[model samples]
Target: MASFTTPDGVTLAYDDIAPAGEAERTVLLLHGFASNRSEGWRRTGWYGAFERRRMRVIGLDQRGHGESAKLYDPADYTREKLAGDALALMDHLGVRRCDLFGYSMGTRTALQAAILAPDRFSNLILGGVGGRLLEPSTDRGSIMADAMLAEDPATITHPFLRSFRQFADEQGEDRRALAAFVQAQNPPLDEAAMAALPMPVLVVAGQRDEGAGDPEDLARVFPLGKGVSLPGCDHFSAIPHGLTKATVFDFLDGLLDDPFEGRF
Candidate 1:
């Protein structure tokens, strides 16, 4: 239940888990939208897996989610601001460098953080995201916001929106705050920024996820990146899938063995 105040004065909640043995490395876990650290990482068995690898894990509840300070204004949840919160947490913990494993919405934050401070990360594992990283797409924020505001989930017409509302309700999340968060849309990271990344990266997505786009195509954009597609999984289902974990662990293990194994 530890917490830190961002420069913007938002109090973000986080959990710091020590490695099972002498710490070999540190990993920062970023959860997706409308999801917290516990549900996204801890309950998904991510914390234990990392612990088994002797990696210290730091999972944070992004602003307006989980036990952190919730703001009603959409302007407060920008990508830069969210990224800053993560970097600030690292500084607060005195961790000079670490690896980043971000899923879905969290992937955007991690990418922005890496762009903001490339030297701060050794490797990056981007999961549940793909081709959307390259091109600008329709903003679904309003739809999601509308879904959150809906009085009855059954009344929501759009299947995507309705599903999100149902998940939020099931999780008992703060709908108003999440609605505001949706309003605070993240700016596109663009290909130029990703292509220039110097650290090793792995792009992962479910083969059947429409939102994920083409992971192989997305990976090609990064100078030092590779892609892995999990079979029979969608964006939501991919997060907790065994294949996703295996791919990430394999990529991370490779990094541990030789940080520049595949680099020219």
Candidate 2:
């Protein structure tokens, strides 16, 4: 468990895993809402894949989740602040640049970071993101936002009851803690902010994402970016595997040569 104090003086946590042989590239993995580093991409063998590619992987836990500093204030969970935390960690670790892989909320933060500091990253892999998340404000969004702030574990867990119970039993994540964490961390980004990001972005999303941001909508955001729709995958199932992993690696390979190229 390593830690860094952000510019805001909040402590952030991260796990650094180095490959056995010579390192090729470094990858920073960011997890989604209500989840930590180990629970999201790390469990999917992404760290191992990076190891196979001789890449050093950094898995970070966002504030208020995992072992990071828990600030219960909702205002502290804004997108700008979240992105700043990543940069602050990078500064602490002496990393000039690195590739980023962010899933769901993590991806949103990654987008903001790339926009806020365009030169901080070599490339980006955004999973489960396609467009502005705060748009089309619905009654459902308000309800979920309130339920999240209220810290109602039952209502939060009802959708993933079986999975949540199994995860708690297996991984020791307190459902109530996660529920409260998720409920309080609802930050929305406006369209202008979303469109300002500059990078060669790769957007990957599940074909069936339960009425979330449409894949096509996300793909259209960056004129030079490419979007890929994962077949036979729901949100969780779209994780890079087999051919999918190869696809991402190929994209990363190209980007490593020319990180600023907007074309996929």
Candidate 3:
């Protein structure tokens, strides 16, 4: 376990998992909203898998989540700021470049990081997200904020909102702080930004994930992107699903062999 202070002075917690032998590559894993690195990667068996493949793993607890400093101000959770924290973590460890993996809300941060520092990342693996990244949609953030702020989860009629509230309660998250974080979410990345990504990209999502929109559609926007589906899985279930791991690893293996090969 280690910690680093962001430029804004918030201390973020992270874990660096080394390979058993010499490392072939490095990967940075980012978790979703109200989730930490442990539950996101370590608990899902990602750390072990990466280590087995001789890949160094770096996982971080984004601000207001896990062991990181929690702030109630919405201003503290901007997309750019969150992305900056990831880059800062890399700089702290003297990592020049790495493969980036992000899920759900973390995917937005990953995309922003790639956009801001295009040369710092070699490949991008985005899970639990899809075409929603290309256009604006309903304010799910506000709905989630309201859900987290609700006095009673059962009182929230919206099914998704209720589910999020229950999940947050289970995680023992600071509801107020998470609410602020949700409210601070920036707008989705535009078409131009998505098209500008020059590195090989993989977009994966559950077959039944309505929240993710359409993975295939999202992949088409990227010049060097491909989409994979996790059969018989939903948004939450897809994260730890075996199919997700297989698809991601296969995509990563292809990148390792030939980074320029765009087709999967």
* Alpha-carbon local distance difference test for all models: 0.87, 0.69, 0.87
- RMSD values for the candidates in order, in angstroms, are 3.8, 4.9, 3.4
**Sort by TM-score, top down from the best:** 3, 1, 2
lDDT tens per residue, model 3, 53-110:
8999999999999889889999999999999999999999999999999999899899
lDDT of 1 by residue, 66-138 (tens): 9999899999999999989999999999999999999998998999999999999999989998887677746
What lDDT is reached at residue 49 by model 3?
Answer: 87
Clash statistics: count for each candidate: 0, 2, 0
Worst 10 residues of 3 by lDDT: 255-264
In model 3, residue pairs whose N, Cα or C atoms come closer than 3 Å (at least 3 residues apart or on different chains), thus clashing, are none
- On TM-score, the stronger of 1 and 2 is 1
Across 1-264, the per-residue lDDT of candidate 2 in tens digits comes to 888888888887898888887778888888876678877767787878888898988988988778788775556777788889888888878888999888886887888888788788888788876654546544543344444444444555446343444444455554444444444444455456546556667777776755345655775666546677666666666765553575578778764333224545
